[model samples]
Target: MLTEEMMTTTEMILMTYLFEIDEWLKDKKVIQQQQAQLTKEELVTVIKNDLTTFQANQATDYEKKLQTTLTTLEALSEAQFQKMKLEILSWGPNVKHVD
Candidate 1:
């Protein structure tokens, strides 16, 4: 079981990471809406923007999954971190396969 100090440290780290991810996703969604109004050539100018947004969303989702696993692990003593690490790794090879 985590000492109070360890739990507090973990909570801070998790909160900061989650906040960053949430902000990134919000920014991405705004950019994506703007992208939706572009002409083909103009849209090409923002393709990288779109791709970055897509990746951000994917990362956020994976991080959320990891966070949930961590929370459960903290209480259950399961190897949640390692299991979530593997799940995160599996997503890397297929990142560009987005539709």
Candidate 2:
């Protein structure tokens, strides 16, 4: 039951998510390159920290955002679209405002 507007917004969200995933994967490559230039223990520690962050929070956060966006998009109407748009827009400012 998604309206045209809703579908457009949802598509935008999915595209943004894909872009973020791509950037993070790129970051992984950069980290790998950095690791290659480091001594063994330093490389191991950096990688371990990155993996822990990925497992404990970053990946889970993105997955949740994507799932929620998809689930909500499936049942969207015009009013719902506007509301969701506001919520999505707010996320950025709220994040920036956080310490």
**Which candidate number would show the highest TM-score if scored against the true structure?**
2
How do the residues 30-91 of candidate 2 rate in per-residue lDDT, one tens digit apiece?
A: 12233224432342344344445556434675444444455544455555544644443344
Worst 10 residues of 2 by lDDT: 28-37
Off by over 4 Å in 2: 1-71, 93-99
TM-scores, one per candidate: 0.24, 0.27
Residue-wise C-alpha lDDT for candidate 1, range 10-97, written one tens digit per residue:
3333333223435444542112234223333342334334335546534675444444334433453334444432333233222431
CA RMSD per model (angstroms):
17.3, 15.5
Give the clashing pairs for model 1. none
Cα-based RMSD of candidate 1: 17.3
Q: List the residue pairs that clash in candidate 2.
A: none
